[model samples]
Target: MTWARIMAPLSGGQGDPPTIAAAVALAEPFGAELACVYTPADVADVMPWMGEGFLGGVQTTALESLKEATAVGEGNARKAAAASGYAKTHFIGLQTPVWAGLSAESRLSDVVVFTSDPARGRGPLAEAFQQMVADEQRPVLVARPGLKVGGVVAVAWDGGKEASRAARLATPILERASRVVILAAPKASSRSFDPNRLKAYYAARGVSADVEVLSDSGDAAPGLLKAAGAAGADILVAGAFGHPRLQEFIFGGTTRTLLGTDGPSLFLSH
Candidate 1:
C-alpha cells in the first residue's frame, strides 16, 4: 500500500523534471524513496572496419554526439532529484542497453514513472518505455508533457485481478478525490460480473463512486479518453495489460496508445 521507492528515467530533456516532481509530490506524503535512472551512451572500444575511402570524420562526430547526450541526460536527472528534494536519489549510469538498465532498476522499486520527451519523436524509446510498463508489473505513473494534475479521477475497471490491483493502489489518491468514476469495459464472454460490484466495493470503503459500463468496441482508448474529459478527470487510473512474458516479447498496444494520447495523468498498475 505504501510507495517505498520510485524509479524515474532521465534522458536530459526539459520535460523530465516536471514528471519527476509530480511523482515526488505524490510520494512525499507517503515518505517514499526516490531513485533516478539514467542510461549512458555505449561507446564501442573497437572501431568498425571501413574502407580507406570511408569517412572517419563522421564516425568521430557520432561518438561525440553520444557522449554529449549521455552527459546531458545524467545532469538533468541529478538536477531533477536535487530540485525535488528527494530524500534518497540513486543515479545509475549504465553502459548496457536502456531496456536492460530499466528492467534491472524496476525490479528494486515500488513504482516507476515514465516521462516522454516532446523533442524526441516517440519511437524506439516509446516502445521500450511501454515494455518497461508491462515488464515491471508494478504501478506506473505517466505524466504528460505539460499537464496540470488536479480534481476528479477516473478508474478504468474490468472486474479483473489487474483492475482490482489498480483500484487498491489508487485508493490513497482516490480517498482524497472529490469525485471518482469507475469505468467498466465489457469483454467477450458467456458470463460477466456486474460493474456495480466494483462501485459498491469502493462505496463500502467510504469513496463516492459512479459506475459506467463501456460497450465492447474495437477501439476503447478514444472512448475512455472522451469519458474522462467529460467527467473532468485530471487523473486516470487503469490496469496495465498484457501477459508477463508476452509483455516482454510484444508491447501492449492499449498501454502504448494511452501513453501517446492526450488527456489526464495516468496511474497504471499490473
Candidate 2:
C-alpha cells in the first residue's frame, strides 16, 4: 500500500508554513501530490443567527468582514504552498461550505498532515484535526519540525484492534524506514500478545523489525515514550483513542500523553 496523495489542511496563519513543509517532506519520498487545502472559518457558522429581522447594517458589515478574512487567508495559504517549492503541490481554496470541502479532500487522500499545534488542540485547525482522526477515521501524520520519513520508525503494538489497524495502515511507511522496532508493554495491558508476531508480520512485507518488550512501569505511556526515544525513532506509529463524553470527547491516557510530547512525530490511526 503506497501513498499517492498527501493532504494538508492549512489555516492561512503562521501554522501554514510548517504544515505545508511537513506535507511536502512526506510526499517527496513517494512522489505523491502534496494537496495543500486552504481551510478558513465557515461564515455560515457565524451568520446563522443573522436572519430576517437581524439582517441590518451590522449583519452586512459582519458578512463582509468574514469574506475579507477568508480572502486574506486564501492569499496567505497560496503564498505558503508556493514557498515550499514542491513541484507536485496543489493549492485548493475553498468556498462557503469549507468544512464539507475539507472532509471531501481528506476522504480522498491517503493520509492527512498536521502541525504540532493542531495535534495538541490549540490551533485554528484543531477541530478539523479531531474530525479527521476520530470522526472521519483517517490516518494522520502529526509532524514535528524538520520532518523526515526515512529514519528509525517505532511501532506501538498491543494486539488490539486499534493498534492492529494502525500497524496495517502504516505498512508503506514502515517498509521505507531504515529500521523498525515494535515496542510492546504486556504488563501494562490486560490483553495477551506477542511482539514477535508483529515482527514476523513485517518480515513478510520485506520490513525487518526488532521486538522490544518494554518494562511496564504501571502506566504505559512513559515506558513507550522512553523506549521510542532510546531507539532514536523519528516517527511513532500508534492508534489514537477517544470516547464521547457528555458534551466533549476525552482522549485516552496513552494517546493524550503521546500527543503532548515534543519529539518523535506520531503516525496515528483511530
Candidate 3:
C-alpha cells in the first residue's frame, strides 16, 4: 500500500534537513500529498505568566515571537517543497504544543517523518514522535542525519503481528529499494520464520531480497544492526511496542535498543 497522505513535521532545528528530505523523497515517487506541518516554538512555555500590570509587555513579545517563527517555517517549507518537486502550496502554521499538534496531525496523515537523532533539543518532539509510533499504530519514518532518499531498506522480521504490520506499511518504500533484506533469527521454537514469503511478496512487485538469520544472540537488536550494516542498509524497518512504560520506552527491548541514542533512520509501526 502506498502512502497517499504524508505529513512531515518541521521542528526548526539542525536535524530538519534529513527529516524533510526523506519525507519529500518518499512522497515524490508516489505523487502523494506532502504537507509540511510547521509547529512553532512553544512560546507560552518560554513566556512566563505575569500580573495584569505586565500584560502589555507579554502580549507584545509573544506576538513578535510568533510572527518570526511563522516566517521561518514558511521559508523552510518553501525550500523543502521546491527540493522535493512538490507544488508550492498551502503551508499551515499551527501555534500549538509540539506533542499535541503532531498527535492530531498524525491521525489525519498516512505517515509522519522525524529525524532519529536521539540528541534532541529541549523540545518535546522527540518523545512525541516516539509516543506516536508506540501508541498510534501508524508508520513513522525516522530519518538519520545525512539520510539518502532511497537505498538498502532492511526489515527487522520476527514473525509477529507488529513486524508483519511494519512490513506491510513499508511495502511501497520497499518496492523502490535498491536492496531488501530480512533480518531474522530464531524466535519461538514452535514457529518457523522464513523470508521466502516476504521475498516473494517483494519479487511480485519487482524487488529482490536477501535473508540472513542472525546467530542466536538472545538480544536481537545488536545482531539486527550488524546484519543491516553488512547489507549496506541505511533505513531500518521494525515494529514498536504498543505501550512501553516510561523506562522501557527509553531503554528496554528491541525498539529501545535500536533507537537508543540514534544510529540509523528507523521506520516503525505498532
Candidate 4:
C-alpha cells in the first residue's frame, strides 16, 4: 500500500524549511496528507537546569512557547516553498511531552519525517526522535532540509527483520523512485542474506530492483554509502540496529553513523 499519511514534526527553527519541503515532496507523489506537528521545548522540565535564571524571566515557558511554535510552524508549512499541489497540509500543536507527541502522531501516520541533528545526540530533541523510533512500531525518515527525494532508491538489505521491515515500509517511496538498488554488505557467505530475494520481493510488488554485493571489509556504513552514491540514489533506506536509546546515548552504531553522513536523506525503521 502507498503512504496515505505523512507526519512531520517541526520544531519551528531554521531547519523547518528543508524538513517541511522534503516531507511535502515525498508526500506529493502519493497525495499523502501532510500533518505538521509543532513541538515546543517544555520549559518547566528544563528551566531548573537554566542555572543562572539570567535569561530565564524573558524565556518562554511551556504553554506560551508551544502556541508560538504552533503558529509559526503552521505559517511556514502553509507557505512551504517546495510544497505544492492538491495534497492536504495541516498543523497540529501538541501539549504532551516531546516523546508523547511524536509517539501519538506516529500512530496516526504511515511515516514520520523530521529533521535530525547529529551533534546533539544526547539532547532532548535527539532523545525524543530516538524514543519515537524505538517505542513505536512505525517508520521514521531522518531528513536534511533542501535535499530532494527521488531518482534511484537504495536499500541496505541484510535480510534481518528490521531490514525486511524497512524494505516493506519504504514501498511507497520505492514505488515513486526511478530505480531501486538493493545493496548488501557481504560477509562470509550466508544463505539467509540474499539480495536477490529482496529484489524478487520488490518485483512481485511491481517495483524492480537489482542486487549488488559490497565488500564487508570493515564497516557496513561506508560500503552502503559508497554503493548508494555510485548508483545515484537520492535517498537511502536502512534497518536500524541496536536499541535506540543505547545507540544514541553512546552515539554509536549504524543508525547514528548514517545519520551523521552527508549522503542522502535516510528512511529508517526499527
Worst 10 residues of 2 by lDDT: 241-250
lDDT per model, in order?
0.68, 0.90, 0.70, 0.73
Error of 4 at 76 (Å): 6.9
Strongest candidate by TM-score = 2
TM-score for each candidate, following the candidate numbering: 0.75, 0.96, 0.76, 0.81
lDDT of 1 by residue, 1-270 (tens): 356787776665665677677667666766777777664444543244433533468766766776777787778767776787677655665664656767788888776776554211353245446555565676777766443333688998767776689888888778777789987667522346687887888888888889877775765677678888889887889876666564443435666667668778888887
**Candidate 4 residues 93-117, lDDT tens each?**
6664655766788898998876667
Candidate 2 TM-score, C-alpha based: 0.96
Per-residue lDDT for 1-270 in model 2, tens only?
Answer: 689999999988999988988999899999999999998999878877788755679888888888898899999999999999999999999876888888899999999999888888897898888888887889999998757888999999999988999999999889899999999999989989998999989998899999999878566888988999999999999988887565245789999999997879899999
**Candidate 3 wrong stretches, greater than 4 Å:** 41-85, 88-90, 97-100, 118-124, 145-150, 187-192, 200-207, 242-251, 261-264
lDDT pick, better of 3 and 4: 4
Query: What is the lDDT, from 0 to 100, of the residue 231 in candidate 3?
Result: 84
List of clashing residue pairs for candidate 4: 18-145
TM-score of 4: 0.81
Q: Which scores better on TM-score, 1 or 3?
A: 3
Sort all candidates by lDDT, best to worst: 2, 4, 3, 1
lDDT (10s digit) by residue, model 3, range 170-238:
888887788888888775223577777777777787778888777755778888887787888878888
Worst 10 residues of 1 by lDDT: 116-125
Which whole-number lDDT from 0 to 100 does residue 16 have in model 4? 62
Q: Which numbered prediction scores highest in lDDT against the true structure?
A: 2
